[model samples]
Target chain A: MNGGTNRSRFSDLVDDRVDEGVFRVDRAIYTDKAVFEAEIERIFEGGWVFLCHESQVAKPGDYWATEIGRQPVFVMRQTDGSLGCFINACSHRGAVVTPLKQGNANVITCRFHGWVYDRGGRCVSIKNEEAGYAATERSGGRFDLRRIGALDSYKGFVFGSLSSDVPALRDHLAAAARWIDLLADQAQNGLEVVPGCSTYVVHGNWKLQAENSVDGYHVTTLHSVFAATTAQREARDATAGMGRTESGRIKGKVPSGTYDLGNGHMGLWAQHITPHVRPIYEARAWLEEKLKPAEVEWILNRGRNLYLFPNAMLMDNPSTQIRLVKPVSAALTEVTVYCIAPKGESKTARAARLRKFEDFYLTAGMATSDDAAALEAVQDGSLGPPSQWNDMTRGLSDLVAGPDRDARDLGFEPASSCPDWDHEGMFHGFYRAWLERLEKGSGVA
Target chain B: MSTNGIDPALEREVTALINREAMLLDRRRWEEWLDLYAEDAVYWVPAWATEEETTTDPETQLNLIYLKNRGRLEDRVFRIESRQSWASLPLDRTVHVIGNVLVESAEGDAVEATANCIVHVYGKKGAATRGSRYDFAFRRIDGALRIARKKVIFIDDRLEGPVDIYHL
Candidate 1:
């Protein structure tokens, strides 16, 4: 690891020495309260963060409550068929407008004082407006609730930004948009988020999950138990001549790699399991009928773990899931995981998808619990003085150059070249983008 | 007609079975706990959702766990016992208290029972109290009451936090 050099205010927090392909981030970034607060302001508040799936608010009156950094926000479907993202706080006294996790409501009245707001976020009624002596105040829209600067959807995935100056959602998405297209293209009609998310909090920094989502390096080691169990099941199934597509078949060797999608986005791609065991495999004929043969092959053969910067991740193949990470504190993070499936899937395909989801990502499942434990242990270890810098140079030497290698590569476009599956280039790219956003001191528009 | 009220004799037998299952979990006797289930048993721990939400349909709704048969349950136990389950590496000390056992109905060979359970977990991180409602369907297999189906609804479902289901 290279020694750090002071560059910006948070330079002490991240050591980005790209010349030597060495990136070491200070552990304090995970445990320091001040650093956490600064991240909320400079990173999350400034960048485009995923809010919820469009299907969650498919109906005009539907709304799903979520947060960007510490700001509570809700995404509601307006009568005009457009989605409106608003701050959950009421303009009156700053109380939360909608307390429910999710529901349908034509008009949301603040629970505190019954200040009614329409789906468009215009304050239509203030409890006893006439008694408040606010004839001019009411007409001028003084009490209209504040709205998020940008709200956009790409392939049914919704994202909101707190800063208006941030780039458009399409520009923010960049290369990551291609992976999202792959995910949405699985279904002919579209994909829908399964109802009821598996929510849990981890005693670790939010970045741990961000890194873990694309960190293929830890799968073989941290989740060895899962691998072992799968191996045993496969042995037994083979002995019994059971040819059913089991969920826990261990893949011995397959081509895999990592891509550094631009705008802090990264993806881990690998070979998919047998078609019989995976829904994407079962939907091959259907997808092929609608899509080109190469497109169908890409959907079936490639398994993707796409990270949309700061928070959300879409895990495609093996099973489809959306992981949303929210930082509660420097050491406490909340995650809500949703299982998503392509619309109009056969009953057998949906069942297989659900089973595969349970085998991996569920709270009690083999993989997620293991990852959670490892992340918590990392957080605990970082609290001590033993280690200061967390190294992310595993596959840095093998990073494939982007399209604009001569200039500053924003990683906006995909390259035919790929890195080793277990490489740490994704982490390097992620932290680089994170440091840039922090240094810019505003949204990376 | 059979009485709708709890059957005293059946309640004692069912309560003992429930307590025995808890003891096996606390002691980490995974194989023995596995023996408490019949060959074709279904174990479900539904995700925490609103009161109106129906999690019975696992395909449509989310569940923390939904094991179809005894084989899958055995697989879960094997993972924990193999010392490969990272979450169960430093096994947390747990004490399960099973009470309020009510035998809701007793058919010819199957019995339906509800019990309130409180699991106190003590680990290196800290201690936590998890409450749940356990609905069980017990079948008399070879004159021994074995769990055919177990549906666990965690009372603290809304609280999104680390959940170690190894001992649940």
Candidate 2:
């Protein structure tokens, strides 16, 4: 309530009841349209949203169109080889320019009436001899498309924010940046998107999947089928399962810890609620033949999952796959899975990695089956009366507040912790930062 | 049999091979189905419709899925055998109907047959039942036609959710 007092009417329903070991949150957070609208303004717009990588638009005329917080935008490589992002709308009649997903174009022409613009977002041509259109006062900028307010990248992962008041991408990413770097640093030739996407739509809310990304608790209940199959590899001792900080990390990685970087970037290393078990060593000799020893080390082991708040997720080691979620409605979300491989990886090595990936996490996986079932069921429940509150109390007692009110220290018991708090931590941080942007008087940035 | 100037005998042999392969898949006789491939045979599925020229390398093309060489195909079969294979748990039932078996070319060492196929996949995992059709390619390897590629371009390729476990 300290920061959310001026938020939309929906925040008033938040059940702030916190017990010693757990916290009970209201289910209205998932069902309210007002809350959802607030989320688009606060979270999606206020937090750093991943757009694309430097590798994607490396040369001039190269462009990729996508959305950041419901605002359709395109990221293009300028003539000088620098990257810039702008709204995809045309200036003439507000039509979308460069509608294609990806292509190399020097001047993007609006299909509606052929109003053309250069790669630098300058409206260079207005067709049919329009007289006063060039001086139109309503245009957002020189181009009909508005430039993305803030854009930046760490390593090669480029991100853009809609709100001018949100924190810098680097400061917002905090500890999560190292995991993303490890993804590229550990790759043999570094990673690149493997051409096509494995896409599909689910009948559920977008936040459900975002929360599921780091919620280790669901592996036992919702993904029990996956557990039954992977039980062979699940940790039998206290130190083996998800709650333990050293379960999946290298023997000496991170010293068995969880870090809460301020501004909502959370790192739950070695605590992958699910499992990452594939025989990467079988291809190590084959990988070493094409890469240096250090590169092979990075490619074959160490890095795990990296999540930039809101919607993007990356798996660093074994192989790289990015899951980008786009919400179609309150009850439907479209998720696209792009498998990534090193630029010059051998055919055999690439195939092996792809097969291993499909075997474990693709649309053909046990966990995915469980998630689809769960998401649909949650949507069904939301249709009935919304629950008064949703509980997020698992590790509330262990939370040690830092000097910053938004920062806190905690242990790794994400599996049993309330509201799926480990995953919710970053989400809540995103929400708080987003709320600050919407309030007229709140100081942000 | 002679849909497009294809020789009768070659057409019969091609149809028989495809029917046998379909029978193998239906019976879950994976080992036998795999036997019909050439040692260096490549199995591919283009994500989109192709006009005779599409790269077989999954890395280069925007393919829905591709399996290179016999070893890779065998690996796919092995995944189904693995206990953890989530996609194949309720083993999907499919009927592959192959038609329009025409020998586009009868060049040396390899023969290409362009065919139309309607595959019906039926199964239930919880409450979800998924079925689809396939516009496919079958190639004559060492004189007998084999499933070089079975690409099931789903009518809803853009939808989100777990697509069913098996190919249609």
Candidate 3:
């Protein structure tokens, strides 16, 4: 009922008022607390959201804690090798079961009341069980810890949904699977998440980051410092006779475009640089030997920033990165970034990957630092009354259907697409999916 | 502990060098800061976690800040001085508290030293205090101590917000 009430108000906050072929969004959507709460209920809780990578919990009993719609949840690898995702609260007193971020544990015991649950989420033990409960109560299902509605993985990336009515994880991923395959296929032995993460809080709405993840328009302007540094580094390397420049990967003309992968998934594709210095490029022979030629071509040419609707963004350009966006408040978001690499790689290639990752994705990295500041500034400006609409109309005239190669090889129909990298069609497609989800109400109990 | 007491003059010189470096950083004298490093100097700020040992290997471990040589450090300073880094716009005013300077060892021309450092930063957002243990490997070059390697281990590794360009 609350979601329904907010759904009616969302229309007022988001104006489709077109001005000179530009679509404008009102400022209220970014600052409204009610809208934020509604989004948590309708979108986050009612759909399949990414949890953690399967490689992160490869061994049995390994667990990783995270949140789904503000509710603390965790995923653990069972003895049978299946993943079990459970609400982090104990069934007895509702206290958090495991407080640590991640670890290896067969039984997670609630420190509050000592309620223990196995990796399967079955209630296995309780402190003072005989004295605190009757025989009938002890054997009842009331004490069993609740499991998430669904748990599934595609290409080693785990996803969970809070609502049972939502489609399967693969169905939820849909056309996005093609890009996921390209990311995973680059590794000869599959991909693994590198240890450690960089986390920082930003004073901005969560949606801003989701849009910024795939928006290529801001790269040349907002990240001018990074561009300049790279150019200078390349020139210096060439002058010093260093043979090859590491920054050269980002140089020169690379054909770029954006594709709407449907179901709120979108991708920005750009041509890759030389393969000698890149790990993905270095894996070419192995990948060509393993996968089809088209798939290999996708891996070679497809440098992508792929967004999995709601929370996760996988970037294969510059370096492999996985960014998780968590909403703290209507005007606040916390981001966690992780570097991913091929399972087995030479030390030289791995080092190259790490260097590329640190160059742009780290907290002190040029690109992220700029984007964080810019987002906060935008949040500050949205409070003003003069500008009610944010225009997303660049490259609207160049919109085209998805390419035939995508349709034939990946089973992808001609979805919305644009040849230019700096297009607003991806943003429009994202918001369209967002509006549909918000209007559908919270279909989960 | 050293069997023989540290030379008071050596101690004074090392302490003075650190204090001068701090002053140069606070004043944003980019070129002077660059001159304090040897050509092969390494400046590292290792990542921190609650219950894990501080990472020392920049090649394998994640580091908040890792510069391999003087060229990388110079490039970093160049970015800050270019007036194009958005994070440096309206720069945060900072004061460095360098104290408890100790000469841990002296071998050949290289002297290993340890010190306590706390930086208080004031910006438009708010204020933040970053406390760290500074480990320095200094070698005498051109009759003056130049840093061969400087490692900063932050006491509280979890940052309160985005790290300023020059705070470390």
TM-score of each: 0.92, 0.72, 0.93
Interface root-mean-square deviation, each candidate = 2.4, 6.4, 2.2
**Which residue ranges in model 1 land beyond 4 Å of their true spot?**
A1-8, A234-251, A403-412, A415-417, A442-445, B1-4, B51-54, B158-166
* Model 3 chain A: ten consecutive residues of lowest lDDT: A240-249
lDDT of 2: 0.57
TM-score attained by model 1: 0.92
Give the docking tier of candidate 2.
incorrect
Candidate 1 vs candidate 2: which has greater TM-score?
1
Fraction of native Cα contacts reproduced by each candidate: 0.50, 0.27, 0.31
Model 2, position B149, has a per-residue lDDT of 54
What DockQ results for candidate 1? Answer: 0.56
Q: List the residue pairs that clash in candidate 3.
A: none
Which predicted model would earn the best DockQ?
Answer: 1
Selected candidate, larger lDDT, 2 vs 3:
3
Error of 2 at A331 (Å): 1.3
True contacts kept of 2: 0.27
